[model samples]
Target chain A: MNQPYSSALLENAVNEFAKLPGIGRKTALRLVLHLLRQEELSVENFGNAIIKLRKEIKYCHVCHNISDSDTCSLCSDPNRDDSIICVVENIKEVMVIENTHQFKGRYHVLGGVISPMDGIGPSDLEIDSLVKRVSEGGIQEIILALSATMEGDTTNFYIFRKLAPHNIKISILARGVSVGDELEYTDEITLGRSIINRMPFNETFKP
Target chain B: MNQPYSSALLENAVNEFAKLPGIGRKTALRLVLHLLRQEELSVENFGNAIIKLRKEIKYCHVCHNISDSDTCSLCSDPNRDDSIICVVENIKEVMVIENTHQFKGRYHVLGGVISPMDGIGPSDLEIDSLVKRVSEGGIQEIILALSATMEGDTTNFYIFRKLAPHNIKISILARGVSVGDELEYTDEITLGRSIINRMPFNETFKP
Candidate 1:
């Protein structure tokens, strides 16, 4: 919809809302109007939360995941497998893998993957910290649990080369049809790879 | 996805964002994470916009429309016809009509429609103020431009009864197949009504 002339304050609020990903002018207007109808205290609280998040939120010094304190809860928890670190593209991926309850290891968020097209490289990520963590020793393995994209491959390869000298075992997430997917609908590339890398029947049955 | 635990500050921001009309936990997390990646100054500006919007915004005394001051630009404009008032359910409708540039009159925002299920009544809206505006004796016409819903109809009837005593010229927004709509795909009721109330070809071409 064409922008209608309104009060400057309303316009400003709408413009800020429109800046959010996936929000357009119409949705922004609706959101701003909804906020206008809300109680002043609630709106203030909403604003304060965002402000406090940016002002006081910190990153885990050990893994670079977002945290309330110096170290993330997972990093500080001794029960988690610190010796087995899962390297991921971002904090969201860390959360995604953590939800599966499959891996009990700690994480190292690269902040982003290597995408030279986007001006992102190994230096732009937390590769040096990951290498340092391996150099410090006692790290049994480093799992390159990144997405199966060009950038993900680039990041995985870069990290692999760096950890090769340390003689640390490196692994990438297995490529396969996702759980609950129909075999008929599964992509051919993934199906072929999964078959080629098929584990022993007893080993698969153990899980 | 099951919620992966994160910082309390991050959770608070996500919770606040989730309070919006259609935002869910996942989308809220995405928005909060996006804000987290932004510059501190930009996030602060976003927060301040909401705070300032709630703190400084006011309603126009005459029409109950949202305004930066007691009197809105529409209400105070000398070029607008004060004699013709457009009664709408909310500020959004006012903007919608204003965007069409089809009305050169002032507006009366009812804030919301009368809905017993929602516990909203004529008293809860700006009905009393609208009656007062009509009773003051300058208004010649009132265009009831509300949604075509039960609550909208109820509010229109209620307002119509209130203004009956003032004997002002009352009208309603035209209901038909929307402009640029395909007749075959239009709802039956609207299409039937449009045909029954069809205007002359010359009259339709005038605009």
Candidate 2:
């Protein structure tokens, strides 16, 4: 239903908010109304924050991850292993992996997976830069940390084939039932993969 | 968990987005990233729309509804009934009632209900303006179209008492089972009220 937004300004704000991914018109109205209720300075800050970020934000020249500088912090950090790079779909994956604190390597954000349905091909991603990074020769291993979807697998295989000539160790993320997941609730494909890729119990069972 | 946002600009934008009602950090990150993926001009438009709205929006002098001018469209319309006024909690309710195409009368937005928990007193709303409007002598009816919650009921009663001295006909939105609702699935109070306030068959029956 068309919202009877009495004010053109309110309508414009609501329309702009609705354009965001997953936000419906009703939700956009609610969000706009909530913003209206806020202090003018706070709302200004909210708008300015978005504008400023978009206007001035940079991507790492080395990894293509979002950064304030030419090179991202992770890529610049001397403590992180320069010999290993974790290749992922986007910066969100970098944050997720960092939160786990399990990976202490650099990241290479592909921007997105090679999805044919969405018309996102290999050229659209940072695959060429990734190949160039590997060809430069300090990297000993590449971790394919993309999502386990068909597009992710396709991207992973494409990267693997491109980097095969370099004689570097390339590995995809281990597929298994999640640590806290119940066996009964685990899907067939994941359960099957977990069984097939089972490691020695001693490696996982820490006393 | 702390997000390892490589850029402070990105982090600030995410923080601002997360401050919005119902938006969490992850969702904020996703939205911010989506904006980042859009064309620079589109992202600028999104930000500018919000800023422009907050900076320029005006409230109607007569009805307190959001408007571009001193008087709202509904209040200024010559065809709308001037004798009756629909008292609503906010502009959203006004829009909802208007969308129904039922109320030809103008609206008086209270801005909010009397909620002691939220520290919102009757004085905090546009109740004084409503009283002042009724005291001016042309209004014949006041329809309290507020929500059905205890706070709504309390506000309705308060408004009724306030408008009692003005000698105007006071009414409220009917509380009953909703249209298209199954009897078995309806709440006890609504079902009971529906039965108690059962209307004449001919009045409601179309076929």
Q: What would the DockQ be for model 1?
A: 0.74
lDDT string, candidate 2, B102-197, tens digits? 889989999999999999999999999999999998999999999999999999999999989999999888888888998899999888898999
lDDT tens per residue, model 1, A1-207: 676745889999999999999999899999999998899999999999999999999999999999999999989988998789999988888888988899998899999998989998788889999999999998999999998988898889988988899997899888887989999999898999999998877886665
**TM-score of candidate 1 against the unseen true structure:** 0.96
> Cα RMSDs of all predictions?
1.5, 1.5
Q: Each candidate's TM vs. the true structure?
A: 0.96, 0.97
Relative to the true interface, what fraction of contacts does candidate 2 keep? 0.83
Task: Mark the regions of model 1 whose C-alpha exceeds 4 Å error after superposition.
Answer: none
Cα-based lDDT at residue B37, candidate 1: 85
Docking class of 2: high
For model 2 chain B, the run of ten residues with the poorest summed lDDT: B198-207
The runs of at least 3 residues in candidate 2 whose Cα sits more than 4 Å from the true structure, single-residue gaps closed, are A205-207, B205-207
How does model 1 fare in lDDT?
A: 0.91
Clash count, predicted structure 2: 0
Per-residue accuracy of model 1 over B128-148 as CA lDDT, tens digit each: 999998988899999999999
